[model samples]
Structure formats: C-alpha cells, structure tokens
Target: MIEESGRVVSIEEGAVWVETLRRSTCSACSANAGCGQGLMEKLGVGQRRGYVRALTDLQLAVGDGVVIGIREDLLLRSSLQVYLLPLLGLFAGAMLAQWLALPEAFVILLALGGFFAVWWRVRGCSRRGVDDPAMQPVVLRAQLAVCAMPVEDR
Candidate 1:
C-alpha cells in the first residue's frame, strides 16, 4: 500500500476530503544541478496540494489528520494506462501511415491524431474511475494528535 498523511478538509456521507502536500524528491537526485526538472522544482513549478476523496468508516472531523492508502497494483496499472497507451497509439498510427506509403507530413499528423485519440479515451476512463472504489484511496487510520505541552507540565 502507498500511504500518505493528510488532514481532513471536509466530510461527506461515506467519505472525507483530505488535503495532502504533494512532495517530490528532485532535490535528492544526483543530476539536480544539470536537470531542467530539478530547476523547475526549485522554481516551485509542481509544488501544490493534492486533494483526495478517501472512503472511510472512521468518524472524522474537518481538522482530523488521517493516513490514506491505495494498492500498489492499482497505482502501477494507472501509470501504465497514462503512459504506455499513448505511446502504443502513436506507434500504431505511425506504422499504419508508413505501411500505406503516406507522405512524411501526413505520417506525423496521423501519429499525433492517434496519440490525441488515445489520450482522450484515457481521460474518459479516468473520469469514470473517479467513483470506482477500487481506484479510490482509502483512509487507513486517523493520526493521533501529539501533545504540545511539556511532560513536566503534566
């Protein structure tokens, strides 16, 4: 399970909206100095909060902290759907155009068309998966609040 800690932002009938900080490891990469991605991270390009509607049975309040998780297999499948599908579409389109002996410009255009078509299909699938319990993250448990007071004060 891939787990993340987040704070509950809102409550619904059977779920809670949790807000988590989107974290990256770009700073730890050895190529950070020469990587455009590392520079982009330095510029805060992808730093943002992520909101997830996690299904939960625990009684949660808006300020409560919780740990949420999704299955590793689900994450892997989603990754493949987002990345491999488009590449396959592009290759298929290019192969078909080449086999037909189409002009170079037409081949590029057809490839792009195929890529966009598959991307559109993937977007639709993601939308439909929004309500799928198997795809959605689940609240694993609520985080216990730490006491701010010193032990001597007790």
Candidate 2:
C-alpha cells in the first residue's frame, strides 16, 4: 500500500476529504542531476497541496490528521492505462498507416486519431471506476500526535 498523511478538511456520509502537502525526495536522490523530475522540482514545481476523498469508518473531524492508502496494484494499473495504452494506440495507428502505404499527413492524422480514441476510452473507464470501491483510497489510521512538555513541567 502507498500511504500518505493528511489532515481531514471535511466529512461526508462515508468519506473524508483530506488535504496533504506534496513532498519530493529528488534533492536526496543521487541521480537528481540527471532526472527530469529533479529538474522540475528545481524549477519550484515540487511542493503543492492536494486533496483526496478517502473512505473511512472511523469518526474523524476537521483538522484531524490521518493516514490514507491505496493498493500498489491499483496504482500500477492506473499508470499503465494512463501512459502506455495511448502510446500503444499511437504506434499501432502509425504502423497500420505505413503498412497501407498512406501519405505522411495521413499517418500523422491516424496516429493522433488513435491516441485520442484510446484517451477517450480511458476517460470512460476512469469515470466508471470512480464508483468502484477497489479504486478508492482508504483511510488507514489516525496520525499519532506528539506531546510537548510545558515550561513548568520541564
């Protein structure tokens, strides 16, 4: 499971809206110099806020800290669907156009058409998955709070 800590911002019937700060480890990575992500981070694109609607049965309130998670398999499947499927469609369309001895303009047009078609299919699939429990993030647990000693106690 991929987990992230966030603060609950709101509550719904069966869900909690959590706000999280996005963090990056690119600075600590040895390949930061060679990574495009690192470059993006250097350009001040790393830190940002994100909101997630996570399913939970626990009684939580606004400002309560919690941990939320999603399955690794689900994440992997989504990544492939978002990135690889359209790429495959593009290659398939280009190859088919070439096989048929189509003109350059036709090949480009078919490739773009294939990419958009697969993208549209992916959008539909994502919309349907929104209602699937397996696709939703689950609240793992409440975040632990730390206690500090007062000046008098210390």
Q: Quote model 1's TM-score.
A: 0.88
Return the TM-score for candidate 2, rounded to 2 decimals. Answer: 0.90
lDDT of 2 by residue, 51-94 (tens): 99999999999999999999999999999999999999999889
Supply the global lDDT for candidate 1.
0.94
Q: Which residue pairs show collisions in model 2?
A: none
Q: Give candidate 1 regions above 4 Å deviation.
A: 33-36, 39-45, 151-154
Best by lDDT: 2
Worst ten-residue run, lDDT, model 1?
Answer: 145-154
Candidate 1 backbone collisions, by pair? none
